[model samples]
Target: TKPKSRSLCMANPSAYNYTTDIFTAAALRWLETGRTASKPFFLYLSYTVPHAGGWGSWPRAPEDGNPVPSDLQYAAELSWPEVERDHAASVSYLDARIGEILRELERLELSSNTV
Candidate 1:
């Protein structure tokens, strides 16, 4: 069945460290759930790597109480400041995830249609 309209679900802000399931699942749902096939659709993703508010973000601290992965891309360099390296690692991790999403969109043939 086709959906009459698109929808949004607002999650209560919490310190939960959700994994890629948070992102990939939503994209899969939008693509496979018949919500936007053969019609115009829009998605808004405000990534949180740069967001200062942890409680208001999706990828908060791990809901399972585990520490966030260092996501280090520069671990080979032992001379850099920890804070700077960690921050870069986080951004690098995010970029890779975004790339995955983009590749998925292309696999679905939705890349040209997406903004």
Candidate 2:
């Protein structure tokens, strides 16, 4: 098996600032460099926000109201819950990044080839 590599970022509030993470960025880079319709590529993408600091595992999470910081411009004037506002921002950021990947795939003519 390949060695497990990890990027350690403080999971606490506002620790994350960048819109795209190393994994996603790397995937996009790979897609950008050499994308072919004949070759099959698999990406196992996972995210932390909206899942981490979520209250499902423990009820106290929501009660504690741990406010997190998101992209300054993206997070400004939001209509979501205080604690989960960061989650919303995080999701949006991720969505935008994914959109970039999708656009690259389309540009490379790999969109129709991908599952």
Candidate 3:
């Protein structure tokens, strides 16, 4: 059945991580359920990393602070070059998490037949 609305279960309206987390959670849930154990599944994991604008604000503090600004706040205050490094770091973190999920699939012996 088609979704009646864009919002699916617990959706966060304030950050991109929320979207990425939702997709990752769904994928993990499907992998956990061995019910459709034999069927080939196509997982379209769309992540929202590295995309600026919409929802989060990036600038409310100085750019040269010790701890640095929060991810959302940093993105808002600085220019592209300044924010790019932090954005790249955030993407790297997401990639690592996704890699871990893939490793889990391989461990379950569901990578081949379940793909």
RMSD after CA superposition, every candidate: 12.3, 9.8, 9.5
TM-score of 2: 0.56
By lDDT, the better pick of 1 and 2 is 2
Off by over 4 Å in 2: 1-19, 54-80
If the candidates were sorted by their TM-score against the true structure, best first, what order would they fall in? 2, 3, 1
TM-scores for all candidates: the values are 0.52, 0.56, 0.53
Give each model's whole-structure lDDT.
Answer: 0.54, 0.60, 0.63
Better of 1 and 3 by lDDT: 3
State the lDDT of candidate 2 residue by residue for 1-115, as single tens digits: 2223223442322433442565566787788877689987776667555565653231222333644344345334433445465666667878887888888788888887765
Worst 10 residues of 2 by lDDT: 55-64
Q: Answer with 1 or 2, whichever has the higher TM-score.
A: 2
In model 3, the worst 10-residue window by lDDT is: 53-62
Give the range where candidate 1 is weakest over 10 consecutive residues by summed lDDT: 6-15
Error of 1 at 33 (Å): 2.4
Q: lDDT by residue for model 1 over 21-102, one digit each (tens)?
A: 3664566666666543346567776665644432333333344454444774533533444455566667777788778777
